[model samples]
Target chain A: MNLVDKQLVKNKMGMRLIRNKLIKQLFLMATLFAIIILGTLLYRIFTQGIGYLDWEFFLSFASRFPEEAGIKAAIIGSLWLMAITAPISLILGVGTAIFLEEYASKNKWTRFIQMNISNLAGVPSIVFGLLGLTVFVRLLEMGRSIIAGGLTMSLLILPIIVVASQEAIRSVPNDQYEASFAMGATKWQTIRRVVLPAAIPGILTGGILALSRAIGETAPLLMIGALTFIAYLPENIWSGFTVMPIQIFNWTSRPQEEFHYVAAAGIIVLLVMLLIMNSIAVFIRNKFSKRY
Target chain B: MLTVERNRPMASSISPIKDNSIYTVRNFNLWYGADHALNDICMDIPTNKVTAIIGPSGCGKSTYIKALNRMVELVPSVKMTGSIDYNGQNIFNPKFKVEELRTSVGMVFQKPNPFPKSIYENVVYGPKIHGIKKKQILDEVVEKSLKGAALWDEVKDRLHENAFGLSGGQQQRLCIARCLAIEPDVILMDEPTSALDPISTLKVEELVQSLKKEYSIVIVTHNMQQAARISDNTAFFLNGEVIEYNKTDQIFSNPTDKRTEDYITGRFG
Candidate 1:
């Protein structure tokens, strides 16, 4: 090649390398932007709330005085909410997933149902609150009870669980199904014995993540009329409840600056609960993934 | 039984005929949606012998074996027309239960697919599904089935270990043991040793030879020498049709059809 042509190629190659580096730096910045925001939020919450995370802060109930406010009632209320939401969502969700994957024929009608389910997962959480208000609260006359709020939360997470469970069930290898069926196992027997066990770890991971979302949800419970000032634990499914998010939301709205710190403390508690639930999910997935 | 004796006929014939036939497939044609996967096929699989189906890829050898136990029906779009009579009962007869048919006809796949459970549990899966609840009975079944598959000694001490822990060859044998636990009369193997090492392949071939003493065995293989080595009868398939069927020695030594001779000679697949 001539010297001029060689020089031109070198210039082009240098430009291309610079362009690649520029795009890589741009993507790196985009990722770091999200991490920076999350880091700042975590830093702010931990610093502002660490002082308020004493035993006394956990023992007392919501008070007009931020110094006396606590999350005892909210903690119990969130637990109660999960007690109802987890089983209802899991049973209904996994059942629906199994039916859609295993039993339902791949026809126009099933496709229609499948499309609607995917659409439901994207529907806003507040819209589900409105749904719960209509169906569980006013229509059922359950009155601001834990069951009413829990059922609403279940409805909110049902689509998420169902979609995740469907993916899990679908991921089971066809060989497993064939082997089970070739052994004279009936459809139900194959599903119950082989499919369900193989799909459980996935189902549990998804179901737990969905349940954690329900625990952190505020707008739905608020719309369902969960009290912001409950001082005692819910006595039954019919009893009034106040979850951590609603309590934290209430404190954030207060005029006193001290209340903001209390809200940060509530956020810390909620984050810890979510972390523990997620850890359990990871544990179950790792344990079962190794087996199969 | 609803006998449809007027089904269209196919051309291939089995020679050196035996009196006791486990499966008599007559004009069996299968279609996956609009695509005809298996054309009219006819063969009499002799009882108490290893019958091998040899074919190139996508020639419907695997499909033919799957059809014996009605496992092909699992595919949503599959449609079949014709009859496969098993022990004098038409398998496709509406009155004949598929579960009962499967309980009598077991299958081992090309890949070793033991369940992600204990070795003992894998062998007992079929029996448990068949409603054998007693632990003592299950223990005996596990031992007998493993022994029958020639896997008893290798896995005896580690019966409680996960089946996945076994070697690939052992896993395949465990699957055979699992099938034997159901005590099926006929065992269908779809390229059972195709995924194994040469040593493992020879072991499985020997197992098949031993297994045929009691259970009727029908195997599909891509390896021509393996067919000659282990099978009593061999059927050559091409383009979804059975080109020739005869005694293994006759087919290998003196193929009747020109195409069969070419396939056997490795001139063309």
Candidate 2:
């Protein structure tokens, strides 16, 4: 064949070898970049911090330096915060979602409320902290203890929970709702029986992720005047408390090298907790994704 | 088993009784935004019999059925006039409860949409909503309804299993059982078995035959044979109007209107 014929007969993009080679190189490079980013984060966390994760460190309370610093109070407080935050936010979010999805007629105000909720979820966490300081702690007169912090966290996570709940409620096939409706079921009956049960997996994943966000929250609690030094277990919601993120923040910001080690241990604990939460989120997601 | 085997199906049998008219639709006109979907139609669905409304798709068959239960009122742009009188009371009356009407006039969709729950829960859902909380009562309902749908023997052991885990046929049966549990006055099926296999279709058709003894059934089906097989009274609808409505055997064998005959003969649907 002539040069013109040979050119036309080759692959459309280019020569076969050239196209294949470029694609393979692109794939490898993309993968390599991902691994590098992940590796950097992992290396920085482990090499700098894993050495400080000993039994003595875990048993200690927060101090000026690594020698006396521990995350016991912070750990316990976070657990308390989560215990209060998750269920309350879940109930409120799911309630709002049901109202919007099932009952609310399409109107300008309802749509505006729904749209702004999603927007609120994306708002900076620090803004929520400031707002919480103004609203819950100051205006409502709830002091900046675990309770106040938890209520603030609830608001911070509420938007995301609502949006997540709406998604869960929406994911239920219209057929299931129709089936329940056709079964002489009232609107609430249908929702409680068919829609809620079907959307449970979706709701659970959203709820867990929302709780995870609550666990990672620091900015809101800090601004709400969360105590930086709570050495003892929190007795009530109104008492002074310190969350794990605050402890990590307190340590990481300190100039002393020894304090950094304490921060590392805090980071490790937070990471392990996050890891467990994330795995559960993944398990639920996979389970529902398959069955649903 | 009242066989009117005459060339012309005795129209005398049309309004046989006074108190038996379950849903009396009088001059029903419905509009969807600008389109006049249902045009001044009147229909009487007798109690305790399967009334199949057969027509080409988009001929107001589904719309008219939905209107009877006030479900069509759910759409924002839908404007409906006239009343649906059920058992001497207009269901669309402002004093009547919408939720209660919907509960009484139960519906089954074209697709098999069992709640993604256990077979037991799916059956018990309606009664639970109506406030039947006693375990013994609910258990009896679960068994009776599933048995009513011809599914108890197959699904009794798998009560706790998710309804989605069932085959499509079983899921459809579960939906029917779910409806039956409420013991509604009228049951509306919008092409319930159109999504199933022939065997599944037969099961549903048989279920319909038995259901008519307790509940007035209004069904919309695309299959002419299915209408002929299961329906006692048939209404042939075209262009949102009832072309011919008479006994099922008459509609299939000898329709009074040319449009109904053409539809049954497959010249046009």
Candidate 3:
């Protein structure tokens, strides 16, 4: 109502607008900082590695010389490791999730178990490697084999998958469960027919992310004593193996400048593999979401 | 003796329920944790007839019906005492399996809940789980059940289409057809038409009338007129107690209890 008060209100409004713009700029800068760093890293990798990524680069085996070195053995070994890791972790993880979600009552013991599982996911991966060394390699006599590495990787990612699966199962509408139960469906029948189908898209997304993490993991494999210079592909679950990360790690640490370029090429292959896996998961999730 | 009288409350009589009764509930009480959801419920649900339960919200009508098939046990903290006999066998007996009780008593909800599957698959799901796997038998069951629910003509050509593709009323009918596919003796509908349009409600009321000729139906409805229109017997529940159980005409026209009269006349819920 007064001239002085009106001017004060106008000044306050201007200051508030200035503050809002400043915060918006700050957030924009924060976002762009991450994007720019990632973009620069990608550009560097592509430029450093593109010359080495030829047909022969995928077909030949790792050699003493960088010019002749390839990731064929490492690629095959990683595939073999994943072939062992994916099923074991997924089945066990999903099974545990269903039991906890559908069957268990809400009690202190189950809550404790749930809390510990979440904590287990945050534990350092090297601890799992030590466990694998003591249990799988040394105690169980599985000694530096693909199965040892696969089992270690599985333990590392099992918590992530279980948590993801529990969320998926929980997200299914209560009405769906009630409908199935009213039809005289036993618990198992209802789960098999209704719950699993509805939750598959979410479960697949989690499992793929876990698997991609398993693929890129180097510390656990190194701790389990995976060979860093394997020139031959693994023949079976029991055979000694070296994955792409181990090969890349070895190349990056070598004295030769050419080996660092080779390491970049190996990183590109790993990224592509992760991209392919993630794309398949996204495709399946979209198809299921649309259908349902 | 000129007309069948389902008028008397079961507590006032010493005689056993008639042999034609599909369910005999005696002094049944249910608690959700510490909340008394259903208190001292006593009634007889007649076979091959429509029984409508009319009540205000939280009056235990849905709880009582769900207890008939022991579906109330799905809630973790539910506690119950007293007996509900389905076809002369106590459903709560340890020897009595829940699966068998549910096989005979299927429920439809207030909301249309169709499985996200093909219409044919949805119909066949109950029978398929019950071990009727032959294609010929499943096909016949689908056809008969869909026709029984009066949903065949609209969905017959699109049996393979997902059940979610249908409208709400069609989906409700599909759920009914799915229930019928199991060939259950009783169908428990919990306010099935509360979510429907007037035309759809009329269609479902007609279906319920026709359905009772083959299967016993117990429907809970908030709409007083709908209960009077579709039900042969009506029970008026208030505050988790059945205030009156009688023929539908008498309940609407001459409710013996003042509470039932107050509820039906819309003075207060």
| All candidates in order of DockQ, best leading | 1, 3, 2
**Model 1, runs deviating above 4 Å:** A1-9, A290-292, B1-15
Tens digits of per-residue lDDT, candidate 3, B1-269, equal 42224344333421123548989888899999999999998888988888999999999999999999898899999999988999899999999999998998999998998889999999999998888989999999999999999999999999999898998899999999999998999999999988888888888999999998899999999999999999988988888888888888888998766678889999997
Give all candidate RMSDs, comma-separated: 4.2, 4.7, 3.7
Q: What share of the true interface contacts does each candidate keep?
A: 0.76, 0.63, 0.76
Residue lDDT tens for model 1, A7-116: 78877998899999999999999999999999999999999999999999888988888889999999988889999998899999999999999999999999999999
lDDT of 2 at A252: 86
Clashes of 3: 0
- Can you tell me which runs of candidate 2 are displaced by over 4 Å? A1-13, A20-24, A287-292, B1-19
- Give the clashing residue pairs of candidate 3, or none: none
Candidate 3, residues A176-244, lDDT tens digits: the string is: 888899988999999999999999999999999899999999999999999999777788899999999
In order of appearance, the predictions have TM-scores of 0.95, 0.89, 0.95
True contacts kept of 2: 0.63
